[model samples]
Target: MENKTIILTGGGTAGHVSLNQAIIPELEKLGFRVEYIGSKEGIENELIRESHPEITYHAISSGKLRRYFSMKNFTDPFRVGAGLTQALNIIRKVKPAAIFSKGGFVSVPVAMAGRLAGVPVIIHESDVTPGLANKLAIPFADHIFTVFKETMGHVPKEKSTCTGSVIRSELLDGSAASGKELCHFDNNHKVLMVMGGSQGSALINEAVRENLDRLTKQFNIIHLCGKGNIDERLEGHEQYCQFEYVTHELPHLLHLTDLVVSRAGSNSIFEFLALKKPMLLIPLSKQKSRGDQILNANLFKSQGFAHVLEEEQLDAHSFLAAIEQLAAEEEQLIHAMTEAEPPKTAYEMAKLVAAHAK
Candidate 1:
């Protein structure tokens, strides 16, 4: 088969970028050459350039579209238009067969450019509540893919498909079978892993830090602190380890964790399900355009794959208490979580993109 060239756009946060990371190898296997277009300042561009340096990289200045009201919104259109111009140039130069977007503000311009160039545009929405970029780009896209069935109702059904979420290839491998062994926790330990999505959550970190002593007594924790203002001392608890990020040992860490305390980003929630690890989700506030996080948390809770707690309700004592309560029902929770197992989202989406690519 001839190698098909494609441009992948998504970024600003890990959720958007990680999907690009997950699909690259699969796209390559199917004889598709992939390039990434993202904001130079977005997390995706940095992570992609570092991890996969050889791929084509183009940076654009696409400001975010805030939900409530912000002065930046007025000027964002000009930036988006400039980004679209750059993206059009790239598309003409690369002549990609298709464009696969992960639905971030940065994706808007690139997908628009692809549409203008008559390239097939495919977008993957990783939220229960789709973002403005996805909503605006939907009409231009040839196909739209979502991580949750709940999200499909918000989009035109004719263009939408529920394909779960595309996670990095490494994360989906041996997550269950090696959970206990690789993560250095015995069956009785009730391992706990706390992550605040890609950038971490300050509120979650603060709450966890305040109750570290109580939590560490029974649960072993691997916490990704996300550059919060919380003190590193954590009351001098020996059971907790912290990092700003975790790129290398994520799969091992998730495999070993019994329960994940996380932000309700669609990627994070789906990662837990893909790993069959129950979660204690604390979604970010809707004011932060974290409405998707809230939606994701509610869905996971209703599905019985995870428990949801609002950030405002997170105090040290209450947090610890919730952990204790959930730990007691670990077996039941894990079982409920398993019902959403073996998410082949990346593979399926890759296959679709490959088949549709010019």
Candidate 2:
């Protein structure tokens, strides 16, 4: 019998690609020939290329789907059309059993292409609100998986399943001692991790830097400051360590984290939840995004899984106070996290996707 094959599509941000990463191994283990389709210049291309060389990678043309006005808006529809054509060609050639999409602009064309190719498409939405790209792809999707129960109301009830998020297995096996050794910090002080998502957050970086003196006195800080966002002047600080970003060591760093200050990206927050790390979320302001982060942070806060300090309200002083509050409420947050059901594992999600395949 021919080996089963599946195509995974998603990218724009790490969040969009992360669930695919989590499930790829499971899919491989289940005897599927995994393939990926993403933008030529996207982070997904790099990430998938470097991490899973076994899977074939196809680069396709994709245009950003912006809500606000731009000259690109007129031209981007043509790019999207070109992307759809490219995706259709690839899908027809591969003749895969199913297409799994993590819901980004890149996945929109791919999802449509899957529909046109008569391939089943399964889309996973990570946020409380569906992103514009996911909204556009919904009608073409045969099944929809969501991280939040609230998201079901927005989708066709017959097609939507609240599967929660998929947490990578590697993240759960981190050694805190290894993290402490890597960071050159002793176990005497609490370790605080500040992450600003894949692209980094200027607001979070500045606020954390401004409060470093006060923060360092209380905790050892591991700052994943994003690519090219590191402040060289603070490189030699005794109690603070900063990296452009971490891949292999992220698990260790997360394991060592006593508390977290981060953006409310759905993937990162869900990972923190899986690890039971108490967090202070500073979501991007409405001006910067579609307000999905704000909603994510609010959901976490309401669920007692995290504390939120909106970007508009964030300053050095307030940021520090929120950290203190997170520290004080650590036990409550951990309790909530412990009682919370973990998301469907990658294996389970893979099975669900496979069951929907042609």
Candidate 3:
């Protein structure tokens, strides 16, 4: 007999996609057919649809749930309502055994609909501070998963499990080395892997661009410029590689790299930590509603695994200094990261979700 089918939702950013990337293969190994419900606007829609053409996919409308006062807030509930109806229709048609939510605004509607249908729903929150989507779905979820232990108190403890963040195999194996070589790095040079989440950070791009000559002189550079901005940032860089995205080659870059300078999104941070790479975390504190990035950076930094620099305080000089310090002390940073592991989480999470779906 075929294993029960499950519907997975959540992904507006690489962080959310990172979770799915970690567990999708495991679910397949356990004989579960996983389907996805995500927004067409998110990176997931195109990436998942193209990469896993065989899997079932349902595109749905979604809106962000703003924490600050905004006109968008007034319309989010209506969108959620509509998404719920779309999700219910998907549930009825697919009759999935369960729904797994990675907890973003994109997953809210599907989770709500799953609850109303008496279908068991599971959610995973990546940051120490739960996002608005996860918070809204908390009361309805049958099982909740988290990356950080500090997040336990924020959710219903009985339903919550601390399964460290789900990291893809490429990161686990340190395969990002080739990405560095391809980027024209010399063997003796230190490499700083710069990424600004999935959408790409204009601030980060500008900072890196401003300090490129200095950065290139000291360390090898591989920049994942967000979509459509690579050309703008790469105007005259003949020595370094610039990419809009690098899904397949990230592990190689992660391996061959000496340090990482990335946005403090849970997805990127966990992947870096799993790779045991030292990082200079630049949190997007300017974003009023989503303070999760700031909180994540602080938690990891307090533990001495990485350095946190708030976006406002970050400048070319400060960034360059931080990179120099981290590059010099990479060994200590690597050791600190290795000691922070809570557990082997993805397999356990898969087992739990599989049991429920069955």
Candidate 4:
């Protein structure tokens, strides 16, 4: 117990950092000192620094992990190599009990470095299929934890376990009164929240905005529209509220939301299920991603937790229709969520992860 230090690594997007964020306090309270390694300018830096100032944040050199042919591909490996050296130095100095990675490009070097430094490395994959970064980091991982059982086929079964989704503890503590005070919508109308993942979807945003006049007549709207995408003209509308992105306010906003229209990212949908929110999911098209969201949305639909609207067919009419359908199926969705396996708390997940520490 002399060395309680553990390093958390991930970044590039909010998705990559959320699991790490959820586990930090739990890890800290369990008597571990936390340090984070992320890119100099990645979202993880801002998220960790702003929200958990007590933890030390280490910035290392990393290049974009690309799936397509880019000129930078030639130079990125050098950056990755540099990143590995930096990570190894950090790992040796800290002598952490473990290294937990919520995989992103930033995590690849850390995982590799952890292996070279003889530290146990654990990875958490929330998608049904591992993303490129996770795929690369898997070979270096001592153990892999996944949110979906289906992900087992994609990972080394001997080292992986399906732990189900871990819902952030703060999400369950939301106050309806605080939520109501934050968004001044009429009590008579049910609130519908529209979130297009962390990066926001233009297609989803367009569909919502175009049908706003009609949609608002039935339900009050809360929109997390993504940064720099807000239309100034929509600012003063009484029945609608928009934000580029939310950090601490998310739980309250979700508490006020009776139903949700969202992208089918595993993390977001599972949070909705945990909250028992009936949702209409618009998954990003295959052209836009590796189609992980499509698989996630389809599974949720089969489980009765959501209504799926593929982006290829997304339009204002279909969007509103999906919302209407979600409302009609609200009770059924809640029932499904209630019957499903309950999610793990951040503390439980943190401990399970710590079990793999060196």
For residue 192, model 2's alpha carbon misses the true position, in angstroms, by 0.5
TM-score of each: 0.92, 0.98, 0.93, 0.98
For every model in order, what is the number of clashing pairs?
A: 1, 0, 9, 0
lDDT of 3 by residue, 293-349 (tens): 888899988888898777887777888888888888889888888787644556666
lDDT measured at residue 68 in model 2 versus the true structure, 0 to 100: 92
Off by over 4 Å in 2: none
> Against the unseen true structure, what C-alpha lDDT does each candidate score?
0.79, 0.92, 0.80, 0.91
Instruction: Provide the RMSD of all predictions against the true structure, rounded to 1 decimal.
Output: 2.7, 1.0, 2.1, 1.1
How many Å off is the CA of 133 in candidate 2? Answer: 0.4
- After superposition, the stretches of candidate 3 with alpha carbons farther than 4 Å from their true spots are 1-3, 174-177, 232-238, 286-289, 342-345
lDDT of predicted model 4: 0.91
Specify the poorest-scoring 10-residue window by lDDT in model 4: 179-188
Order of models, best lDDT first: 2, 4, 3, 1
Looking at candidate 2, the ten consecutive residues that score lowest on lDDT are: 180-189
State how far residue 118 of model 2 sits from its true place (Å): 0.4
Q: Residue 68: error of model 3 in Å?
A: 3.6
Assess the local accuracy of residue 213 in candidate 3 as a C-alpha lDDT between 0 and 100: 84
Across 1-358, the per-residue lDDT of candidate 1 in tens digits comes to: 4438988998887877887887887888887888989997888878899878879899988888776678888998899889999989999989988999988899888888998999999988888868888988888899888877888899889988888766666875645445444444443656788887776777787787777777777887778877544355553345666767878668877776778888887777777787777788888876666477888888878878877788778888778878877777767877886666467656666898877787
